[model samples]
Target: MGNQTEVTEFIILGLSNDPQLQIFLFLVFLLVYLITLLSNLVIMVVIRADPHLHTPMYFFLSHLSFVDICYASTVEPKMLVHFLAEHKTISVNSCIAQMFFILQLATTEIFILSAMAYDRYTAICDPLRYMERMSKEICVQLVSGAWAIGFFHALLNTVFALKLHFCGPSQINHFSCELPPLLQLSCTESLTNQVVLLTSAVIFASSSFLLTLISYIHIISTVLRIHSAEGRRKVFSTCSSHLIVVGLFYLTGFLQYTKPSSVSSVVLDEMFSIQYSILTPMLNPIIYSLKNKEVKTAVGKMFQKFKFLK
Candidate 1:
């Protein structure tokens, strides 16, 4: 304790240090952030406005859009600011809060995706009992459970992080204050923190991923059993958007976190992070709109309403 020096703030070494690049990156990320917010907000609004879309599938999707908005909002706003700021420093407390929210929202989103997979599974595998199996009460419980688990998972990580002492270098080599980069800065032995992070991440991520995988396996089996090609295509289309989303989220995230340290580099880290964290949110609404006939119809009707008012 006597030799420990207090670190009140951390200097964030953003993606680039070049003046010209900073300005360019600022504009690029700002545009991406705005698109993320707008697209997600549109998805939520469209889902809410259409009563026909109030099924279990769209209910999960509306929540997913809301989570995407929140997940991007957690990191992009600060990152955009950092792109223009010369110092690009964040207080210790702010960094912790940012990490907490990022973890919570991200965890919640994967579970929500898992829930969607289950919804699709029920709809396709047992159409007659779909309404009974996935009632409004059950859907609400699934969403609420996701949120509750995410909150507690983040809280546990944050509590452990608070115990770590950062007496050494305060420079974070990534765009945002992620747990991995932050853990590297602690002067104290971080073995326990590392263990907890790895253990919990594996437990939470694997369980949700397994559930999604099982749901899809059952779905594919059922789809294959259908005799008509048109029938198979119609069934696949209903959940294809969600399948793409899950692949994007899990694959990028898995690569980012599970890559060998020997192959890790700052550029690779930033690229993977951007893929899952920034670009995915912007792409989600586009995927759903393109793949989903119902969403497209709703958006078309919405545009017609606006034109009529004008």
Candidate 2:
């Protein structure tokens, strides 16, 4: 420990090492980042501009869009820059900050999805009292609570991360400054950090996933009670967008974090990371706008308004 020089910056081994491949990957990821920003911004703008989208569902969707934007923004810009740079390196402080926001925004998104599930449960199971059950105040509280929990969880992990001493290899195998990879490079023991990470994953992430699952179970049961297939389809359509988004998020995230080190590789890690962090944000608005008639209508109206102003 006395002779070890602490690493001040980490060299990120990005997705590709081939110069031509790197340029190609840069173009592809730049396009993805642009779409993520544009699509999420559109979702937010349409929700805000349309009066009909002022309900609890759209309110939650708007926040989800915002989270997706922040989530993608946290990693994509740096990643894009690294893709083209001669030396793909990030300072220790920048890396930690990136990890912090990634954790916070990702955690916040998980809870927000749970809240959306709950909203659907209430809307479908008790339609008459849907508005009352998911009142504006309650919606605000739920969103606020998600953010607060995310902040707390991220801070806890980040504080422990700050205590770690990195005196070993300065090259990160992947593109971003994720906690697990950082732990692998630490000179000091990372048992406590790993324990805290696992504990928080169970407490924050697993709990939220369970809540969402329970909500869907109730929603499905309630839908089954409806007599007509058409009625059931209509009912399911309302929450289908949320369901799809949740599946994409959890599926990729689970594969990324839970996989054994023996089977995990740099390419697989980068692919999973791209899915949940980069591509999912771009896909969310497209899914909602395509699968949801209301959103499509709202977007149409918004475009018409723009044309009218022009």
Candidate 3:
């Protein structure tokens, strides 16, 4: 902490500088955030109310819905406020807290998605032993482990970030206090922090990504062995939504974080950040629910129950 001047707060330069653009963004994002909340809530409710959705896939999906709500809530409220404020600022502690939650939830989501892939693999490849393999006890443990790993990962990032010193010029280029932007603002030697970030990213993000890929590989190979085109189509439909989600998540995440440090672009980074932070959560529920007829029917049934209750 040599020559470390305490930094009290930081300015958050949000998505847009233009007044018109800010207003436009505010409305768009407000609508998007509301939809995210509503859709995820519906997913949870539909899953819980329908015994047909009590399977491992829907169980995992309900948890995923919970995460999507939490993940979006972590970032969007502050971002929405900033769009309307003249000067957007966050205290150092708050920024670190935001980053921590973001990291925790995002990492948890990655694990959840991988777990979902495993569920799908078991369902597709070993339908005979699906129940024996993915029992209720195992599902609980898998989800619990994902949450635990996310918590520790977030704790690690927050702990290391607290060690950094911020002297002045405390303007963050993007809307959030993400690890990379925080590192850019630090006055201290962040070599160790960078190494830790990179290492954790590789261990957490890379491992989960690889697992998903391998699971998908097995799933595809099994699907290809089916002789009937209709049988293949039916099997593929069950997984298409998940595959789309994985592609979007990994694509945006990799674009944002996996780039070489040598290449830096604030605008591009901000765009990609928008994709992962805001867009993905908003899209996930819609994608999963609309694509899966089971979810749609469940939601419809739920609506009918509400009507009867009324």
Candidate 2 residue spans exceeding 4 A from truth = none
Model 2: per-residue Cα lDDT over 1-310, one tens digit each? 9999989999999887899998998999899989989999999999998899999999999999999999988998998999889989999999999999989998999999999999999988888999899999999999999999999989999999999999869999988988888888999999899888878877887899999999999999998999999999999888888889999999888667666667877788888988888889899999999999999999999899899999
Candidate 2 vs. true structure, TM-score: 0.98
Which regions of candidate 3 fall more than 4 Å away from where they truly are?
1-5
C-alpha positional error of residue 282 in candidate 3 after TM-score superposition, expressed in Å: 0.8
Q: Candidate 1: which pairs clash?
A: none
TM-scores vs. true structure, each candidate: 0.98, 0.98, 0.97
Q: Candidate 1, residues 41-158: lDDT per residue as tens digits?
A: 9889999999999999999999999999998999999998888887899999999999999889888999999999999999999889999999999999999999998998899889
Clashing pairs in 2: none
Q: After superposition, how far is residue 236 of candidate 2 from its true place, in Å?
A: 1.4
Error of 3 at 283 (Å): 0.7
